[model samples]
Target: MKIFQSTTHYNYDWEHVSTANWQKYSPWNEKTPHVIAVDTLSRHVDPASGVLRTERLITCEQNCPKWLTAILGGDSKSQVYECSYVDPKSKTLTLCSHNMTYADLLSVRETVVYTPSAHNPESNTQFTQTAKITAFCGGWQKIKNKIEQFTVDRFVENAAKGREGFEMVLERAREVFAQERERMEMSQRA
Candidate 1:
């Protein structure tokens, strides 16, 4: 098994960052071209905690090596099951996801969290992400190690791109919100 962890800070408020999370895969985010589609399976708000819970199915096209594709039965597309929790009271967003495709041969579980930065809670958000990779091919220790390492490397590279894509979305969302605020102010003045 291989474990990967990362921490990043976004120069945006937690509320904006959290809202942008949902638009990470928007068409405007060119950095996430691998993401083909995202579908919401379920969503509900917890009355007691005022937390929103959501389930989603994500489909991604992977650029895997020919050898890897052959080993995995020639499938280049991957599906992931993701669940997210948005706690309004705590001002935190958490996402957990696992690969559904090729689960028998390899497993990848990932978790991400977004919260207000301690240094500047009102203007910055802290992002933390972790992933575990494991290969289940029996009696092939060398191959398993190679698979795990490859996955870890890919995850790290993708993590950077994901952050870039999300940043773009956040910037756009902030612009839209600013425009809306200006409109409201003008209307009120009128």
Candidate 2:
């Protein structure tokens, strides 16, 4: 009787295992393994003091509850940072925030409408509409610039009122103008 010997082979590279595994486990990979897109600005949690704090973008969809809705104000659907805070004791939630740009401020206009009908076919349909105006940051930089220009113009006009020579008034105006500009700049930087 003739017997044939069987061979089993296993491919294992112990030396290169670490390098090969690194890419599979790397956190910086371009594609997230399991990611669900969520509106970051729509998550909120209540504090101990009964006040609601709108959570920042760091909180991802995985951590937040699925019931939250993302509503961006105005005609455009661009998302901004904000959330509706629902109180356990009450049916309403108060909105709050700061540091708004001009575009941000303009987005506060919102309109909502609801329509309900009755069983009677000939009756007119009932409708409800509500409008709200929210406060937003008014692009403080632009306002500050306008104020500074007005201040300088007023100073120059006042200084020229009773001046003897054009050059002397101009020199004094420059000195005052420089001082005012420095003060404003310092305040802004602070």
Candidate 3:
């Protein structure tokens, strides 16, 4: 078993960062070539708490080590089940995801949270992520450790790329918003 944890800050506010989360897999994020598709399984707002809950299935191209792929089979894609909660009142977003493919041999579970940064609450957002990797291979401690470590390393690399991609998306979103606001102002003046 292995655990990976990371924390970072986004220059954008919580609202914009939260909005960008939904567009993370959009075409703007070319850094995530592995991600192929995302399907929303369900979505609804909780009447009591006024929180939004969503479930999705994400599909990605398999990019495993040759030896690992040999053991897992010839499949070329992997799937993940993700659930998210958005508390608008609290300005927090939390996402939990688990690997749905090859669970018998290995498992990866990840949780991510986005919230207003303490240092700059109004203009900055904090991002926190944690992942647990476990190998279920029987009587093979060496293989298990190797798999977990490899996964951890890969995850770290991918996390950085994901951030870069999201940043690009956010920048594009901001530009569009600015243009729209300018147009609205012009129309109002007219």
Each model's lDDT comes to 0.92, 0.32, 0.92
| TM-score pick, better of 2 and 3 | 3
Clashes of each: 0, 1, 0
Q: Which residue pairs show backbone clashes in model 2?
A: 100-137
Model 3: how far is 36 from its true place, Å? 1.1
- For 40-150, candidate 3 gives per-residue lDDT tens digits of 999999999999999999999976678867876767789999999999999999999999998887899999999999999999999999999998878999988998998
Instruction: Give the worst 10-residue stretch by lDDT in candidate 2.
Output: 1-10
Candidate 1, residues 1-190, lDDT tens digits: the string is 9999999999999989988888889986889888999999999999999999999999999887789787657578989999999998999999999999888888999999999999999999999999999999799999999989988998999899988888889889888889999999999999
Stretches of model 1 off by over 4 angstroms after superposition: none
Tens-place lDDT digits, model 2, residues 41-145: 545464575634443221112222223223442221233233334343432233232212233433322221111224321322222222232323356766545
Off-target runs (Cα >4 Å) in candidate 3 are none
lDDT, residue 76, candidate 1: 86
